[model samples]
Target: MSEQQGRQRVDVTLSINGKSYTRHVEPRRLLADFIRHDVGMKATHIGCEHGVCGVCTVRIDGRTARSCLHFAVALQGHEIETVEGLSADGRLERLQQAFHEEHALQCGFCTPAVLLTAEEFLAENPSPSDSDIRAALSNNLCRCTGYTNIVKAIARASGREGEAASSGTGDAS
Candidate 1:
């Protein structure tokens, strides 16, 4: 534990996006806060504070977990992956590209979480069906697209579907 602003804090070392970060935080500090405020990465969005919304999702030790549900101290020595880490050469990754091509995002609040979740799902199931894609995305909430385009984007990323005929058009619900 360390002293910060006259308050007690615990030191946590987190490996995020292939980088290591050590910060003193309160025991109650959420992993999402640590990643965003302490580590200075903004790709992980905080939504619903509770675990009901997957907006705070990140890959912990290669598995998708809600950052809002875990304490910063609990993530010590664990690897975390945010949407910012998914790309190489600063260009959007294939999954992100698919989301763009399929017009999977609107308002853009839930894109990062959905992208992270889709990355994990594709890694585990490279050839998922449309139903499988829908099942995987069920945890993340997107008020804009009604999930049809999101499912199609995942399907395209997984090689289960072809390129979308058009872009930015809302899909059939």
Candidate 2:
């Protein structure tokens, strides 16, 4: 524990996107806040904060987890991957390209989480059915474009776009 301005802080070294970030933070600081404020990455948005919205999703050790549900101090020495890390050099990843071509996002508030989730899901099940995709994305909520295009994007990324064509309501509901 380190003391700063009469406050006790914990120093944690987190590996994010293949880089190491060491910072002194309060013991109770959430990982989402630390990523957004300390590390200065804005892609990890905070939504419901209750682990229900899935807006703050990120890959912890190659598994998708809610950043808002974790504390920075508890994740010391852990591997964290955000949407910013999804791309290499200047080119977007295949899933991101699919999202772009499929017009999967609107308002763009929840796109990052959805992309991260879909990335992990596709890795685990490359040939997922439409219902499997929907079940995987059920935790993430979107207020626009229904879920038609988003599902299509994931399916396209998985080389199975044809299967998702008939699924989804395309309605906000």
Candidate 3:
């Protein structure tokens, strides 16, 4: 029975990326809006606001999903990971470096979300072919003509050796 200026405040707990977060939120707040505004994570961009653009993609539990498609209220006590959480020890992970080495970004607007989505896809299917990667990312839309490098980036991150060479997390390259 808590209240804010006008909206009721409900307790919400979420594990973002790898950290745990607990906060009070308005029921009507969209997850993307809440993440951007409250969490202060600028990486979660909103493009279509409609599920068309995967700019607001995040990982919930272990799967990639659109943050704009759900409400904060519905995500209470859920595990959510944004692009900001993709890094390890403040250093960009292997897939991220792969993006850089493979030149997977243009304009940089969609890179963060695309990175997270690619991470999820690769974690599930390490040996995904170009077409398989394409199918996995069918829901995401990138107009940068960077998908070629992006796909290569995923492939690079999929291998333990490549991941270590790029990620530097000691996975053994």
Candidate 4:
């Protein structure tokens, strides 16, 4: 560890959004801060730094994790994906488009985490029921939209809206 700006700094090289970044960060620096301040990706929001809010969620080595709970040094060789990487082009991905169509966001603070969670969930399940979508989203707190539109958006994105409704799990009740 070397001293930088009065703190112990460690050299780390990590990939973010398909781009490689090498930086000297404090050992205690949160991954969220590293991504936001060091790597300059602002999509990963920091809320309830203790990892309860889930707003700082990102994909670490193909798994969803709370960036706020991990140190940048711990992710030295890891591959992280922020919301900006989800799009192949400069436009919104299907899930993001679904969110927009469903009006799933209000303040938009929780959108990134919610989108990441939905991406992971859909990747594993592909055709998740409404209950499954709700269960996956239960770990995150959203102060807006009441989760009704969010569920619908996920259902729409998964292409299971009718099945979810037929199963009586997508009513938002």
Candidate 5:
């Protein structure tokens, strides 16, 4: 067996959702695996081990990505933010509220990733159009939600249908 493929001892610290976790892990342990197993953050789901589905998505240092695609060893000392980190005092964020009000989910499989990605997107854009939302989230695939309510939810979150239609065409501000 390869060195990193089997269980081996390694110590690291991870800042997740604004909390710190110092633990030992195996080299083969995936970031998603570690996030769920060690830190007990269950929101980061594994949809595709190959990184196609965005269900395993999380924000590592403010950029969203497939947690399954990254290794735990690579996350040392880096700030990780799972979908669970976005709330305050157990209440949902504004984007999440928008999602709920707009009925932006079904089956709830891809909801976490969608929400995280949407969170970062809206923070940067804060006002994106439908096409803009689609383009920003093109990599994420949702079998439920039909990408319609999700789109509308983002638009609603931004407070503008016109905002939802704006491309990443201009400078972000």
Candidate 6:
């Protein structure tokens, strides 16, 4: 660790989207900043720097967490997953495709975190009710599309294509 501007800086090595990144950062540097600035992965957006908003959500060791709430130094040697890693073969994941087809995203600020959250939710609950999908995404905040399309997209991705179609009337505005 070295001193920079009276704050201690340390070296951290972590994996993001299957790529290893080694960066020297301040002890107080949030993982969100580290991912965006140090690692050059801009898919992770920061909102409500206080962690209440889920825009900065990312997977730490396969579990969703608020990146803004964690320190970069504490994540040394940990595996991190961002939206950029969702499609390793240059094809959209099921959820991503559904989001596009269902029009789940508008403005797209919260789409990445929402997609990550819904991915984990659907993995754990493959056949979820509309209510269940809404519950799973309650933590994420989206100002566009009214969350109707987002739920439909998640439902569609979970293999409930008919149910997703029946629940919604038209595309979300």
What does candidate 1's lDDT look like per residue over 1-173, in tens digits?
33564487778898998888989888889999999999889888898999987899898988889999999898887888888887745534778788888888889988988888888888898887666777787899888877878887888877767333344333332
Clashing pairs in 1: none
| Ranked by lDDT, top first | 2, 6, 4, 1, 5, 3
lDDT per residue, candidate 2, 1-173, as tens digits? 33564487778888989899999887888999989999999999999999998999999988999999999888877899998988745334788889899999989999989988888898899998777888889999887768889888888988876455764455323
Residue-level lDDT of model 3, residues 114-164, one tens digit each, is 787777777678787666766776777788753666666777777632322
TM-score of decoy 4: 0.87
Per residue, candidate 6 scores C-alpha lDDT tens digits across 1-173 of 33456576788888888888988887788999999999898989999999887999999999999999999889887889998997675434788888898888899999989988988898899999887887788789888777888888888888886354666643222
Which lDDT values do the candidates have, in the order given?
0.81, 0.85, 0.73, 0.83, 0.78, 0.85
Query: Which residues of candidate 1, in runs, are more than 4 Å off?
Result: 1-6, 89-92, 162-173
Worst 10 residues of 4 by lDDT: 164-173
TM-score of 3: 0.79
Root-mean-square deviation of each candidate, in angstroms? Answer: 4.0, 3.1, 7.5, 3.4, 5.1, 3.3
How well is each residue in 44-116 modelled by candidate 5, as lDDT tens digits?
A: 8887799987889998888998899898888877888887777744434667888888787888878889888
Tell me the TM-score of model 5: 0.85
Instruction: Identify the leading candidate in terms of lDDT.
Output: 2
Task: Name the regions of candidate 4 deviating beyond 4 angstroms.
Answer: 1-6, 89-92, 162-173
TM-score of each: 0.85, 0.89, 0.79, 0.87, 0.85, 0.89
lDDT of each residue in 61-137, candidate 4, tens digit only: 98999999998888867889988888755434888888888788999999999888889998999887777788898
Candidate 6: pairs in clash: none
Query: Candidate 1, TM-score vs. the true structure?
Result: 0.85
Error of 4 at 51 (Å): 0.9
Clashing pairs in 2: none
